[model samples]
Structure formats: C-alpha cells, structure tokens
Target: MSWEQIIFYLFAALAVIFAFLTVTRRNAVHAALCLIFCFFFIAGTFVVLNAELLAAVQVLVYAGGVVGLMLYVIMLVRGEDASQVKQALGQKIIAAFISVLLVIQIGSIVYLSFAGKATGRLAQEMARYGNTESIGTLLYTKYIFPFEVASVLLLAAMVGAIVLAKNKLER
Candidate 1:
C-alpha cells in the first residue's frame, strides 16, 4: 500500500480508538483529553482527504474552540466525583440494541453509496463544484440565510450557557 493509505489508516484507527476512549473513560478530564485526541485525528483525516479548509476548521472550531470551552467549564464546575448514575440491565440491553441498529444502518448506507454506479457527467459536475471556493460561494450566495441562522443559534447557545452558569438573584 501507498504511504498516504498507511497514514490515512493510522489516523482513522487513532480517531476511532480515541473516540471510544472518550465515551468509555471513567474520569471526566481523561474523557475530555481523549475527545481532544479524537478531534485531532479527525482533523488529520480531513487533511489526508485534501480538504485543507475543512481540516483547519475541524482543528480550530472543534479542537480549539469547543474543547477549550468544555475544559474550562469542567474546571469551573470542579466535579471531583465520578458519575454516580449507573445504567440498569434493561437500559444496557436497549443501548446495545440501538447501537447495533445504528451500525447496521450506517454500514448499509456506506455500502450502497460505494456500490452505486457513477455517471461521468455527474462526476465532472461534482468536480467543478467541490472546491473550497465553490462551496464558500454557494454558502454566501445561496445559503446565506441558513448561515446567519446558525450564527444566531450559536449566539443563543452562548447566552444560555452564561445564564445557566450565573448565580441566582438575591430576590
């Protein structure tokens, strides 16, 4: 296999492993660290896919901004004790069933996508519009309203977080 393939698989494996650790780790801080590693590996995968803008955005938005905020919030909360809530046997069974269903669904989708025949015209059209410039142009021109809505949603989330963390009034 090529070096690119090797690197891609390495990053993919690391991303999956770190994602699993993020979910299963007992310590909250350790889980957060695992999530950071997962994000980093995902960014590496994006880089491998030749999507430089996406890779940078993944690192900046998810790894730097979101994870940094989460770490700060964790520290501010000062939650020393591990999670006390334990999953019941029924809940575990349900979770496992749901997970298996999701895995099957995703596998089917991926298999279908790769197994389908591709038209040369459609491939050419996609190539013309798949670049960062084309995507940015479409986002600004056609999807500007949705982009602004996302900004508003993020702003609302920030406000809600601040409000929730603030102390209660002395009334």
Candidate 2:
C-alpha cells in the first residue's frame, strides 16, 4: 500500500478513537481535548482526500473555534466533576442499539465502495475544475444561504458569549 493510504487509515482510526474517548471521558477538560484531537484528525483525513479547503475549514472552524469555545465554557464552571456518567439500563440498551446500527451502516458503505458501487464523481469534477474552485463555486452559487446562515449563527454565538461574560463581571 502507498504511504498516503496508510496515513489516511491511521488518521481515520485515530479520529474515531479520539471521538469515542471524547464522549467516554469523565473529565470535562480531557473530553474537550480529545474532541479537539478528533477534529484535527478528521481534518487530516480531509487533507488526504485532497479537499484542502474543507480541511482548513474543519481545522479552523471546528478544532479552533468550536473546541476553543467548549474549553472556555468548561473553564467557566467551578468544580471538577470527575464522576463517571451513569446511564440507566434502558438508555444503555438504546445507545448500544444505535451504535450497532451506525457500525453496520459504515460497514455497508465500505463494502459497496470496494465493490465499485459507490464510486464518487469527485474525480470527474476535479478533472473539470480544481478542488478549491469547485468547492467555492458550490459554496457561493448553491449553498450561499446556508453558508451565510452559519456565519450569522456563529456571530450571534460570539456576541452572546461576550454579553454573558460582561454580565458575570457586572454581578
């Protein structure tokens, strides 16, 4: 196998592992750190796939902005709740069921791709237009509204955070 494929698999595995750890960790700080690592590895996978713009956005928006926000929120809390999360038997069963379904879905997707049934048309598109150009075209032409909405939502969240901090300082 090529080095690139090996690196891609390594990043994918680490991303999944870190994501699972992020959810399972009892310490909030550790969980948030794991989530950041997970996002970084996900962006690595995107880079391997030749979607550089997506990778940068993934790193900047998710790993930097969102994770930083989460860490800031964690810092705002006073106590360290190191206790394990306890789920009821029913909740555990439900979670296990959902996990199994997700695994099955992923397995089927991999199988189909290997069987030549899931060949994406990205190669053809990239051959016609470069990766960043195609992404920019779609983002500006097709998904402009959603993209603007996301920007606005992020701005609102930033404003809300600043206002909350000011209120706390005033109190």
Q: Each candidate: what lDDT?
A: 0.82, 0.84
Residue 32 of model 2 has an lDDT of 89
Compose the digit string of candidate 2's lDDT tens values, residues 52-136.
7899999999989888987887788732384555756797689989999999999999887777553235666687778889888
Please give the range of 10 consecutive residues that has the lowest summed lDDT in model 2. Answer: 78-87
lDDT of 1: 0.82
Off by over 4 Å in 2: 82-90, 109-114, 117-129, 155-171
Clashing pairs in 2: none
**Backbone clashes per model, in order?**
0, 0
Candidate 1 lDDT tens digits, 1-171: 777678889999999999989877767888888999999999997766667678889899998998888888788887424575674679768987999999999999988888775323433455666657776998899999999999999999999988887799455
Question: Which segments of candidate 1 are over 4 A away from where they belong?
Answer: 84-90, 116-132
- What's the lDDT for residue 121 in model 2? 50
